[model samples]
Target: MAETAVAAVLAELAALEDPKVRAVNEKQGNDHGVNLTKLRALAKQLKTQPELARELWATGESAARLLSTLICRPKAFERDELDAMLRQARTPKVHDWLLTNVVKKNPHAEELRLAWLADADPVVASAGWALTADRVAKKPEGLDLPGLLDVIEAEMKHAPDRLQWEMNSCLAQMGITHPEHRARALAIGERLEVLKDYPTPPNCTSPYAPVWINEMVRRQAAE
Candidate 1:
């Protein structure tokens, strides 16, 4: 009965694919053609089903994995299960969705954050940085702000694309949240110049750390 349901869900996801969108998604290292809004709608219709989510994720289909993250019960996942899922989440979209939707809400988030930060794989480490950046922005009382700045200054420039983006975010968040560290964060950003030349659309903010930091800080001061 469960196998039949999983097969039905996979077929539904397959039917949603668009060649043009899949081409675009492929460029970003994702293999799916499903629009996120449509995927969310599907998830809402399916509702939360942990076992079904696990089965969908095991199918190794990017679209199904994305839908799984949307419908899974975050807290139901064991720490080891989340760890295994992170390792298997190879594509950028799946990796990001799993981190944002599932891992962030897991009970063992901090422990996993530290463990994954020290992970040898940059993609996995990026997830760690993502988790750390969340804390830097929200619950930063005990975190080592200066030390984080130190690492970003030293390693971010040499990091891979995925890791570099996450580290840059952490640096920007650090600057945005802590007035004391803002100038140093700005200086490091200026020195590194990572993503400085990134082609950002006119209305959208650039991902370049210096510009992102300044823009956010400016907004905070105004409000």
Candidate 2:
């Protein structure tokens, strides 16, 4: 019965697959692509079905795994299971989704963040940094903002692409949320010069830390 239900979900996912999106996903290093809207709709239908989610995740298809991230119960994941999933994340999209939908909500989020931040795997470190970024964006009351800025200043230039991106995100969040750190964050941004040359689309915010900090500060002032 469980197998049948899992097959039905997979069949729905397959039916919703878009070749164009799949091609783009492939270029972006994802192994599969289904319409994300459709996938989310299916996940909504299967909400809280951790057993079914496990089955979908076990199939190892990218879309199914993406759906599983939504349907799986955060509390159902053991640290080891989450660790294994982080280790096996093969693409940035999957890793990002897992961090946002699964790991961030999990009971083990703090533990995982601390452990994975020191992990040798770039993907794991990326997820850890992402989790830290999320925390910085929200309840950053007790976090060592100065120490964080120090680390970003020291390591961001030599970090891997994924880790660098998350570090930049964390830096931006810190600058936006903590007024005392704003000048220091901008200074660090200026010093690191990461993504300084990356192009921004018209009317879009630049990702360079100083520019990003300025834009966010502007928005905050307006609000």
Candidate 3:
């Protein structure tokens, strides 16, 4: 059933040259969100047309998700091919997609770990940390605790209020999800005083504001 749906969607996509417009239409059909059900179906039919799937994803608003779905499909994408496509994506959404799909969950997880850690963009950097935390949850042994520490510290130094706040959430996630790492995270959080340095803005979840900051602290402390 999923294969049939994917084939039908691909056939429809092939008949049209502009997938961006199709993407808009698809989004509208799905109440202004990525059609994940359709994408998951497409992922099931990943063989024999990986490149075309990648092309369609490149033009879709839900490209990130599709890319992630594709990455999760075993044997669908070559390592170098995936890396090249990720590098070619210039949009922040695409970058985020790559972070979620390829960098974070790639079969070649170690390679992506190093690459994303070195990325200069805050969006990329934050996503990198997020992925690191996620992967650590799955496989805690031999994890790069030092690298994770470096990223949160860097976030405090270079990231904006919003990202700084996100770092707090990520840390709390790490703390709760991986208890062994909790102490290290709390130690860093206490000494950094990043929340004090940068205040949260109106209508923003900045790390400096009393409400969000306190919430983050509480979450971190939660048993």
lDDT of 2: 0.86
Q: Which candidate number has the best TM-score?
A: 1
Sort by lDDT, best first: 1, 2, 3
Give a tens-digit lDDT track for model 1, residues 1-223: 2899999998998888899999989988888999889899999999999899999999998899999998899999989999999999989899989999999898989999999999999999999999999999999988989999989999999999999999999999988888899899999999999999999989998999889988988887899
Top lDDT prediction, candidate number = 1
Give model 3's TM-score versus the native structure: 0.54
- What lDDT does the true structure give each of the candidates? 0.93, 0.86, 0.55
Off by over 4 Å in 2: none
lDDT of 3 by residue, 56-85 (tens): 555443443343445444355666765565
Better candidate number, 1 or 3, judged by lDDT: 1
Ten residues in sequence with the least summed lDDT for candidate 1: 212-221
Candidate 1's C-alpha runs over 4 A off are none
Query: TM-score of each candidate?
Result: 0.97, 0.94, 0.54
Candidate 3 residues lying further than 4 Å off, grouped into runs, are: 1-49, 58-74, 90-97, 101-105, 144-147, 160-169, 183-223
